[model samples]
Target chain A: MIGRFLAGLKEDKRIWGQRVAGQGVVVPPVGYSETDGSAGGDWVEVKPTGVVTAVARVHRPIPHLHPCAEPFAFVLVKLDGADTALAHVVRDHLEQLRIGSRVEAVWAPDAERHGSIRDIACFRVIS
Target chain B: MSTSGPPKEPVKYVEKQLHLPYCYVAGDYKVRYLAALKDKTILGSKCSRTGKVFVPPIVASPESFAPCDELIPVADRGVVTTFCIVNIPVIGRSIELPYVAASVALDGADISIYALIQECAPADVRMGMRVEAVWKPDGERQGSHEDIIHFRPTGEPDAPLASFMHRL
Candidate 1:
C-alpha cells in the first residue's frame, strides 16, 4: 500500500490513502487499520491541503540533522480526507502556525523527486 | 473485496541515506589521554583521595567521588578480565567474524578498558589471558582507539584469576 502511495506521488503528484473497515482513511497507508487491526480495503486520494493539529518549533538546527537551517516548525497535519494526521515540517510562516491553521503541501521539482516521503518538500501555512 | 485499481509495481525496498554530522569537544582529561596514545603510552587518571585509576581518563572518580588530579602512565600489556566472541558481522567494520572482544585491566589500573583480542582462535581466548597492545606504525597513528590496531596474546601465562578478577 505504501509503495503504491509513494508511486502516486512520484508519477502523478498526488497523495494516496487507504480506507480501513473501522478507520475512515489513513494517509501513507500501512495496509491495515492501526486501531482495529482490520486490513485496509480501498485506495483513496486525499487532498494536499490540510490543517495543522500540532506544532513544535526548532530554533537551533543541528548541522546535517535538521531538514532546514533556518528556524522552522515540525507539525502534525490532518490532510483533507485523511482520518489521521501526518507528521511533517513547515518551513515558512512558522509564527502564524497554530492548531487549526490551514496549510498546503509543497512538492519537490519533478527532476528532484524520487518516490520518497521527501517528494513533498515541506508544507506552507496558508492561513 | 473492493474493485482493484491499475496494476502498479511493488516497491520492495526504499534506499535513503541520512547524514548526521556533529562535533564533540573532548575536554582536558580525554584530550591529554588521546595525545598520550599517539606516543604508545597509556595514561589513566588517578583519584586524588582513593588512588583508583581510570583509562580514557575522566575528571572525577566514580569510586571516591573525588577529583582525579594525576595522569599516571600504565603499561599497554594487561590481563583479560572477561570477553565475548562476536559471531555476527557488523556493518562498516572490516573485522572478520568470530573475533574476541575483551576487557583488559592494564597493569596499575583499577578499571578495565575494552580491546579486541586477535592473532589467535576465538576458542583460545579466555578470562585472565595475557595480552599486549599492537600499535599501528608511528606515522599511521591517529591518537584514537584505532591507533592500537588490536590486542594480541603475549604468550605469557594467563594472570591468576585472584590477581585481576576484582577489577572486572
Candidate 2:
C-alpha cells in the first residue's frame, strides 16, 4: 500500500500523499509514510513534476562503483503536490541549475528496476 | 544463552536482493579537488587560522574550527605513509589480487590522501616509499580520483621516517 505511489514511478507516474481528515486530500499529505520508513506520513496520488530545492554537482569516489559515476548533480526536489522533498540524482542539465528549477524523475530501465527508491534512475530537468 | 520458550514455527522467508546504486555529492570543497584531478593536479584545503591543510578539502579545519577556504595545489609526488596488500580474491573488485591501498601525504600538503597504489609488488610497498600519481591520458580523464589510476613507486630513495610519522 505504501509503495502504490512510488511504484507509479516505474511507469513514470506520480501521486500526492494523502492522510485521512474530516474533508481533505492534502497535496503533500501530513501523516506517517511507509515508503521510506521515516516519512511518518500517509501515501496519496501526487503530480510527477517538481521543483529543485537544493542541488549539488557531485564528483567523488567510494569503494564501490555508482551509477552516476562521473561528475553529476545530486539534488533534493519538492514535488508539486507534496510538501516534503525527495532526494535523487539529476543529470544532463548541469547548466540550468537554480533554486526552483522544474524537474521530473527518469525511471530506470525495466531490467534495472526493483520497485524501491531506486526505481527512478535519476531526476532530470524539465527544460 | 538459549531461550526458555518452546520452539516457534519457522516462518518462510524469501530471498531479497536490493541493488539500489546511488551517487554521493562530494560537495564544494571536494568538487574543487576533483576538478584539479582531471588536470593531473592534487588539491587540499588550508585553514585560515592554524595553517593546517586538509586533503580532499573540507568545510572547516579540524583543530582551529575555522572555515577553510584556501585551495592549495599539492604535488603529484609524495610518500606512501602506510599501505595494505590484499592477497585474497574478492568477487567484484576491479583491481587484481595483491594490490595496495596506500595513504599518501603529497608534498606541500599537511594532510594525506588515501588511494590505490599499483605497478609494484605487494611486498615492495612500504612506509616512506616515494611514489607519484600515474594519470590517464588527457582525453580519458574525468573529474575523479580514477583519473589518476594509481600511484607507482618513483624509484627514488625513501624519505626520512620523521616526515610521515604523524600519519600513522
Candidate 3:
C-alpha cells in the first residue's frame, strides 16, 4: 500500500538542469533548472560511500509497521560531493551508532518506485 | 495486534463548503475607517459644498471638498450592482453550499459593498437584483462582514442596469 502511494506520486520523466550527487558521481538527476531555461544538466555519477555526521535514536514506532523489530536508530548521512545530508533510518542499535561511522547505501532488491527519500533502504554500517 | 471483536463500520464522509469571514474595504477613506472598524465606528466623510456623502470618507472630494461633517445613516438594504456565480468548490470554505457572492450598493451610500449572495438560486440571481442584509440576532453583531448573514434577494424589482454601469 505504501509502495503504491509512492508510485502514484512518482514522475517518470526526468527533469533536466538540476543535478544531484549520486553514488559519489555528480550526475544530472530529476529536477528543474534554476538558471537555464532549458531542461537537462551535465550528468555525472559518484560512489555511494558516505560518513555518518549525526545519529539519533527512535524510541517510538512509526505509524506503519516495519519488517524489522522495534528500537532502531536514524542517521543523517553526508554523502561525498553532496551539499546536504540525506536522512535514513539506521537498523543498528543505539549503542552502535557514533559520529564518523562509515556507511553505504543499500538499494532495495526492486528499487521502490516511491517518490520519496525512502526509495533507498536504510544505510548499513560498512564495518 | 489482531482485534478479537468483529470489524468496525467505516465512517461515511462528504465535503462541505466553508464560509470565511471577509471585510470588503474599498475607497481611500473607507480603507482608513475599516482599519478603525475593528475598534471604532466611522462613517464616510461628506463634502460641505456638494452635500455628497463619502463613507469611510476620503480626504479630498472627487469634485471639491467643502469640509462637511454631515454624516447620514445608510440603510443596509441596497441593490446588487454586479455579481458572479461561484460554482467551483474552494478548500476550507465555511458555508456548506455553493452560493452567489455579489457587490451590493447600500442605500444612501455612494460606494458599493462586496458580499456573499445567499437564499437564492444561481439561476434566479441576476445583476441589479434587490438584496438586504440578513443580520445576526441582536447582541450577536461582531461589527464584521460575518455580522451580516449572507444577503438574500429582497424580491424587489431589479434596478436598471444602466444606473450602475459607470460604477462597474
Candidate 4:
C-alpha cells in the first residue's frame, strides 16, 4: 500500500544540495565551484534515459510484508548530473534483460496523486 | 440473517524513546590517543616540517599537509585558550548544566582540543587558568574519551605571558 500511493516521478527533475549545520564540506561539489559558496551550486538538467548498470532478481518478500507474488527485479540506474546512481524496481522479466539494456522513465497518472521518486513507475525494458 | 458477532480490527500504536548503543572502531592514531586517555595522559602528533603539535593527533599537518606519524606526549597541565559555558542540556551528555567546555592547549602542543572541565564552579573558570586531565581508576579504563573522565584545575602558578605568546 505504501508504494501504491507513493510511486515514481512524473518528470525528470533536479534535487538541490544543502550543507549540514556546523559540519564542513566532506564531499566535493559536483556542478559548482568551491568559491561560489553563497549561491550553493548551479543546476544541470538531464534526461531520464540511462542503461541498467546492474540487476538482481528478488523472490523473497520485503520486511514490510507487502505481497509480491511473482518474481521482481531491482535495477541500479546511473542518471545524468548525479555522481551516484539511483536504485529502483524494474517490471521486466529476468530473461528479457541484457547487460546494458536501455531503460526510460515511466510516470504514473497524476490523478493518482503526490510526488517523490515513486512518481516514476518502474523502469520497463525499452523495445 | 446475521448469526456471527461483530469482527474485531487490528490495533497499532507507535513506541517512543528508543535508545541504541553504538561502538566506534578506532584506527592506529586514535587507538594511541584513547590508550593515553586512560592514564590521564594527553598525546599529540608533531608536524616534522612546521614542528607544530596537533591535539587528538591529526594524521597530517593542516599547514604543511605532511604525514605525521611520531607520537608526542604532552604535559597534562595546560592553559585555556577559549571556552563556552553549556547552559542547556543535551541528550547523552554526562555533565550537568553550567559546565565549561574549553579548548585547552597542553604544554608542548601547538593546537588545542575541546574538552570539558570539572571540579570547579562555573564562576571560577577563566580564559587562561591551568587545567589537567583527571583519569578514571585503572580498573575502569576503557581506552576512550571516557577514560580521562574530565579535566580539572591544576592549582599551579601560571606561566609568563611571553612563554605562550609566540606559540599561539
- Compared with the true structure, model 4 gives a TM-score of 0.54
Q: Per-residue lDDT of A32-110 in model 4, one digit per residue for the tens? A: 3344434323223334666778888787646433224466778886554334456776766567765588776666567
Off by over 4 Å in 4: A1-56, A59-72, A75-127, B1-25, B166-168
**On residues B84-113, what C-alpha lDDT tens digit does candidate 3 reach at each position?**
888778888877566788888776666777
Pairs clashing within candidate 1: none
Q: What is the DockQ of each candidate?
A: 0.24, 0.02, 0.04, 0.02
What candidate 1 gets wrong by more than 4 Å, as runs, is A1-127, B1-17
Question: Which residue pairs does candidate 4 place in steric collision?
Answer: A7-A118, A7-A119, A8-A118, A8-A119, A8-A120, A9-A119, A9-A120
Q: What are the per-residue Cα lDDT tens digits for candidate 3 across A7-86?
A: 32232211111242332222223333334434433332334557888887777765345425677777887765544466
Task: Report fnat for all candidates as fractions from 0 to 1.
Answer: 0.23, 0.00, 0.00, 0.00
TM-score of the A-chain for all models: 0.94, 0.70, 0.58, 0.60
Which CAPRI level is candidate 4?
incorrect
Q: What TM-score does the A-chain of candidate 3 achieve?
A: 0.58
Clashes of 4: 7
TM-score of each model, in listed order: 0.62, 0.52, 0.46, 0.54
Name the top TM-score candidate.
1
RMSD of each: 6.0, 14.5, 12.1, 13.9
